[model samples]
Target: MTLGNRKKNAVKAATAAKVDALLVTHLPDVRYVSGFTGSNAALVLTGNRAVLFTDGRYTAQAKAEAAGTRVVIEKKPAVTAACEWIERAGIQRCGFDAAHTTVAALEAMRKAVTSKVRRSLFHPVGALVAALREVKDADEISRMRVAAALGCSLFDQMLSIIEPGMTEIAVAAELEHQARLAGAEGMSFDTIVASGERSALPHGHATTAKLPRQGFVTLDFGVILDGYCSDMTRTVHMGNALPGEHEAYDAVLEAQEAAVAVVAPGVTAGDVDEAARSVLRRAKLDRFFTHSTGHGVGLEIHEGPRLAAKQTQPLAEGMVITIEPGIYIPGRFGLRIEDMVLVTATGGEVLTPSPKAWIQL
Candidate 1:
C-alpha cells in the first residue's frame, strides 16, 4: 500500500480513538505510516495532514524515503518536536501508543509542551497503528514470501554440512554467513543452534558444546530481507535415533501440521493452537510441548494475532504466522518443527516449504 493510504488509515484510527491527533513515537509505527526507516523519527497524524519529524542525520534519507508526507528536520528530540507541533496546532488531546512509550519518554514529551497542556495532552492509546498493521497488504505478503523463501534455502544449505562433533556455535556461524551471501539484511533474531540436551531448552541459543553422536539438534532461525522477517525451525538426528525419539518427532510434526491445516480466515487463533495441542495431548506428549503453537510474523519477527490458547483473535487473510510445535524431554532429547503459514480465504499456504520429514545425518 502507498504511504498516503497508510496515513489515511492512521487518521481514521486516531479519529476512532477520540483524539485530535496522534503522536507516533514508536519507530516501527512511524515507519509503517510514513515509510521513514530512519533511526529517530516521530509521525504526527491529524485529520488533514501527516508530518514526520526527525533530526539532521536523516534529512536526506527522510526526503528520499518518506514520500507523500511532510518531513521536518529539527534539532530537538523527534518526539518532543512532534508534541510541540501538536500543541501549536491547537490540539487538545493527542494519542500515543502506550505499549511503546516509556514513562521517561512520556515525561520528556510532556516537558516539551506547556504544563497545563502536558497534563491533559498525550493520552495513552494502546496499539493504534499496530492494530492496523495486523493484517498485511498484497505487497507486504509478497515481500514476506521472498524472505521466507530465502530462509528455506539457508536451511537446505545447512543440512549439507551439518554433522556430529561440530559445535553448535559453529553451525550458527555457517548459517549466518550463508544468510548474508543470500542477501539477507540480517537475522530476524539470534541464530538458534541448540544441540542434544541443550535442545530441551525452548530458547537455548548457540553455545560452544559439540553436537552429540546420537541425539537431536534443533536449528531455529530466521532472516530479515528488505525489511520483512521469516522464521522456521527444523530438528535432525545426529547419528542414530532411539525408538522413543522417532515417536516423539513424529508427534510434534503431526501437531505442527495439524495447526497449519486449520489456518483459514475466520478461525480463531485459539482454535489453531488447539489443533496442535490436541495431537500432542492425544500422544501423551502435551506436558512436554511447551510454548505457544505459533505467532504472527511480519515487519517485526513477532507481531499480533498470536496463536496461543484462549486468544480470541480470529485469523485473517494476508496474515502470516509460524506454526511451531515442540517437545523437549529434559536431559534426554528435544525436537521441534516450525513452518511459516499464510492465512488464506480457503485455507492456509505454507510459505516455508522445507521438508519436515525425518532427517537423520
Candidate 2:
C-alpha cells in the first residue's frame, strides 16, 4: 500500500481509538504514514483527514513526498507546530507517542497549547501502523522478495571473498557496500561480524577481531530494498572446521529449519518458537539458547507480533518475520542461522533466499 493508504488507516484507527488526532512524532512512523522521510517530522491524523509537519530542512521534501496529505513547514519543533494546529482546530484530545517523545517535550507541548485541548501521551500511532504493517500487501511482499533474492545472492558473494586475515569491521563494511551495490537501500541493522570468542555475543559489533583460522564466524546481516527489509544469518568456518564447531552449527541450522517448517497462519508466535527450541532442547543445547526464536520484520527491522515465549499474538497471513535460532556459548563461540519468513495462506515463505548449510571458506 502507498503512504496515502497508510494515512487513511491511521485516520480510521484514530476514530476507533477515540483520538481527536494522532500526533505521531516518531521519524519512522511519520515516514510510514506520509512518506515524509525526514529526521524531524510529525503526522497528525484526524478521523478522515491528515497533515504532515516538518521544519525548513525538509520543507521541500515534505511538499514533494507528502501527496494526498496536507503539508506544513514548521519553524521550530514539530510538537510546537502541532500545538498551533490543535488550538486553532479546537481539538480536545491530541494523541502523542509517549514511547518516542520525551517527558520534557510533552510538558513543553502542554505549556504551548491553549489549555483548551487535552494532551494525552497515547501509545505511538506507529503501534497501530505496525499492526497494519505486519500483514504485507502484494507490493510490499514483492519488494521484500526482491530484497531476499539480492540478500541471498549478496551473501554468497561476500562468502566467496572471506580471507583468513580480514578484520571483522572490514568484512562488515564490505558486506554493506556490496549490499548497496546490489540494490540494497541500506542495512536494517548493524551487520554482525563476530569471529572467534566474540561470536559468543549474539549481537556483537564488528570489531578489530580477525577471522579465526578454524572457528565459527557468525555473519548476521539484513538488506533494505524498496523500503522493505530482509534478514539472514550464516555461521561459517574460516578454514577447515573443528568437530565441536561443526556440530554446534549443525544443531542450530537443524533447529532453524524445524521452526521454519511449521510456520503458518493461525499459529501462535510461542508455538512457532517452540518448534525450534524443542530441537535445541533435544540436542541438550537449550542452555546456550539466550534469546527468543525470532521477530517480525517490515518497515522497521524489528516489528510487532514477536515469535517468542509468551508472545500473545497469532501468526497471520502476509505477516513477515524472521526465524533466527542461535546457540551462543560464552567464552568460546556461538552458532546461529537466521532467515526472513513470510507467513502465507498456505505456509511460511522464506525471504532470505540463502543456503543455511555450514560453508567453509
Q: What is the lDDT of residue 146 in candidate 1?
A: 98
lDDT of 1 at 274: 97
Off by over 4 Å in 2: 116-126
Q: Score candidate 2 by TM-score against the native.
A: 0.94
Candidate 1: clashing pairs of residues: none
Clash pairs for candidate 2: none
What digit string (tens of lDDT, one per residue) describes model 2 on residues 177-240?
Answer: 9988887889988899899889999999899888878788888888888777888888888778
lDDT of 2: 0.82
TM-score of 1: 0.99
The estimated TM-scores of all candidates read 0.99, 0.94
